[model samples]
Target: MIGMYDDVVLSFSESKAEEAGMARSMTAFGRCSDIVGGKSITVELKSVNNRFLDCNSRVPRAYGAVEERIKPYLQSRGVVRGKVDVFVSVIRIDGGETELALDGEYLRRYIELLRQMRDEYGLRDDISVMTVAANRDIFTETESGATEQDTEDIMSVISRAVDTFIAMRIAEGENICRDLCKKLEHLGALVGEIEREEPRMNEAYRARLEAKLRAVLEGRGAGAPDEARIITECAIFADKVAVDEETVRLRSHLDAFGAALSSDDAVGRRLDFLVQEIGREINTIGSKVSDVHMTDTVVEMKSELERIREQVQNLE
Candidate 1:
């Protein structure tokens, strides 16, 4: 679902999601370029992740007070999350909506109050042109403002561009998923390799322990004393630090991760959770084992998972 439009030279940026945990952070820029011709308006949307849709608008300074008018356009989009920004620039097109002058209720109230002021005290009898001009809101230029229909026309094309931007994000998310799945497959294979090595690894440790115990006894002149007791204690220590159970559990976690990737639910947040668990398991293995080569292999597995996780952050 990559965007059909060409990539415009829009400024782009990103934030590390881990720094803002549980928050799906994303930023994108899209301009309609030739969006629509409605009262000569050009609209662009800039979006960033937020817990709620907090849209702000910026228009030509002449239309400062009318910025709120743009909200009615974006409000109907049903965006529940994001700090959305809208930029509208008017190009001074002719045939714009002519504003209507008003003889509003406020004008009548003003005149009534002025009459009361004069009659009550017989003071300040002034009905000058300045008195009328002081109530500026009571009058406005005829046909001199933008129309709702005009804003709507411009928004239609801007919507197209924003939707296109969303599609691009989804397309990138798909690619990220593919690459991460491959990395997970490699990590799964490494877990299998480590599992295969564990038994032989345990045997090597047993032999080393047996030899070292004999050396220690001989140094203290007990080389041939209580062999059974020494072997039993060494076996207990080895079993306590055994990583076979941990490796098996790690494989189960990997399987769960694969299923998550293929699931219909949004997996960005889920993948992040799985990755943190994977890291914890790998760390436990590295800390429990004293073997340099085994620890090195575990580090490699973790490194690959970490790289995959960096991509997962971009998913939604």
Candidate 2:
């Protein structure tokens, strides 16, 4: 089996490690060719990101059973989600006898059409056997029947191609994991910054409220504002701008996201859900905090989260 990397064993080992701790990207290509059972068998695999697993195969018409087996075989190898296309080609190398015959009806019609074109358009009269035979569809090949061994040989080639395909995915996935981890760290720091500024935000709101109330009372010639009423109004303002619950939930979601990144299981869908939850908490925090600095920080957090969401879609 041929692979992109020279050290297939080491590449496979690293792939398994990525499967255990990181994520697999759903885009890669692999091709393998080998001589088996006196036949040259080649298999190619290509995949792209998709919301679900969609497997398609293209093989010789005589080997329809090979197409049926490709999908389940891929799933067995942990290809949970992607649009995967497999191609298989086989050539006999043992000097086997084969029959080729011309399609009489198709050849007749093709010749008739060529003559008609020549007559109608007064075109060149250079059409000959070579020119006519250029249309390959005018001939047919009688292929030998497929046997159990043919299926086995083709499947073996497919397995090797998949090995290299998965290794490429794992390598790309590790890079994605590193980028995601950095973004998550930034998110955690932003959450901490929000928490640190929460108390100061409440105090600022309370002071503003008190000053507004005092101004209104003095304008009405009411001598000094009632201290008790001012305290009650400030308390209400503080409660209205409180984001302790939201920030706490946001922090928890960030932690869950970090844990999911290192999980052994398929975490694409799980990470998607966590991003949604995190967005909800960030929105809540945005609504509660009116400070200019806090608002800008929240916007930056949302921007980072959006990037994370886009990156998560590439994972499987």
Candidate 3:
């Protein structure tokens, strides 16, 4: 597989989109820094492996929907094949506005409650300034919503941060692919060894049968035609536990696996299936190879295959 490391940046500037009143099109970007008119608003998108683009935004509730819009942006880049856990954060680098607000509905209701309480307890004052300020929704000051112009400016910044995040993930994917390929190569080598040993194994089985027949006939004069009996029993045992066809099919599957690994497409599911097939072949070998040495070798191959499977889980 070819490892790709890339970053894309698109910007929306207030001065650029002023006539439209809002940014006309969204931009997909990477790690961002926006410096405008001596003030800056920075947005960072940090993405990691996930089953999908499960995004979390660290901004005012008013701007939470921006995460949804980012979905198309990420998909457009062809980098959305795997799970991506994105954390979006917006920071006002140089603050331009500090907002204050009163919840009129909440304040009105508090006043009514104060009046009722004073009458019941015979208190002189019905309302206190401290109590009004302490009421959860009665009063507050904070950064407000993104204006049409603010969106135009902020989007430009966010796009840059996304670019940085994608670059990092691509690099990470590269490293993972490299390690995975090495494991695949090792597995291929082990399969090749089995193929080479198959002929030798057949010869060994014939030798074992002859030795067992002689041992039986040597013990008694009445042991007649033991050669014929041994040949029949040996044939039955060999047919019952033969691994020749298993090895051949497994070798073919290994070649197909190499093709899938090198393809520049969404092959995660395909590779997963191939791994299952490979596991099946190995299990068959373990069961058929009455030889202790062959069984031990199959066990070791399975261990390596398991490690390879784990690394493939993170592929895109």
Candidate 4:
């Protein structure tokens, strides 16, 4: 039930349809707050597109230790490429009052070491309890450091916030995918128009060559022009301007672009490379084809390509 060219056309159409889903673009914001061990901790995540992952965080001094852990955790959670910023704030239910614990062992060891230093240097024995207590290292405050339970609770909230952020980014990426696919479809149609006009170019060149040959022969009083020679010259002109290779490569690039869009991996760099190839092929077509209609079509295709490039810039 299919014609000769139907299979090729259907294959092309199927490839286009396969490009409906992808997950490269990223731009989202999410915030979550929860109560843990009588403290309220809030986690905020904001992400935008970047070629590589660049994660930074702002957290309360007590939670500063988690800042180093957050980057690796986010990278594990599929944040492979972006400019992501995290903000964490903690509010204590006990009015921010810190409970300090004294380390008797460390205090005794430290004072003993100080006395040994003074004796060895033959210095004055003016060491007092007040002087020994001045060092903050002797006391450990509950609010200044995170316990194991606090770290666990913070991670829970962060995981939830990251889920929400990724969800938002995927939703926006789907919309962008649809827009880019539409533009690609339009570009393909333009290429088809050029293809249809391709055969006519040969015909036009042949006719012009024949006319010029006839005019020259008539002026020289020759009986007739060499028909075979005119045909050979026309063939050479057609070869000189042929765009078949460029069009075929352009179509291949389009298919690759679509496939990359629907892939699960980070494809921003791949898509950018494909875009350059597409643009190069289009430029080649523009240079070879001198027909006014084909030239106009090439111009429109370039405009559409530029729009797609702008959108691609936002991808991860």
Which numbered prediction scores highest in TM-score against the true structure?
A: 2
The TM-score values for the models, in the order shown, are 0.63, 0.82, 0.67, 0.75
Q: lDDT of candidate 4?
A: 0.78
Task: Encode model 1's per-residue lDDT on 64-160: one tens digit a residue.
Answer: 5456655554444333345778887666456565555666787888888889989998977888768877878677554356566655665565566
* Sort by TM-score, top down from the best: 2, 4, 3, 1
- lDDT: worst 10-residue window of model 2: 1-10
Clashes of each: 5, 0, 15, 0
lDDT ranking, high to low? 2, 4, 1, 3
Flag clash pairs in model 1: 98-143, 98-144, 99-142, 99-143, 99-144
Q: lDDT of candidate 1 vs native?
A: 0.65
RMSD of each: 11.4, 6.2, 9.5, 11.1
Superposed model 3: Cα runs more than 4 Å off: 1-30, 36-39, 81-85, 89-96, 100-145, 206-223, 226-233
Runs in model 1 with CA error above 4 Å?
1-29, 33-37, 46-86, 90-94, 97-144, 222-228, 263-266
lDDT of every model, 2 decimals:
0.65, 0.83, 0.62, 0.78
Compute the lDDT of residue 236 as modeled in candidate 1: 88
Write candidate 3's Cα lDDT for 153-211 as tens digits.
65566666655655554445555556666777788777777777766776677678777
Please say which candidate is ahead in lDDT: 1 or 4.
4
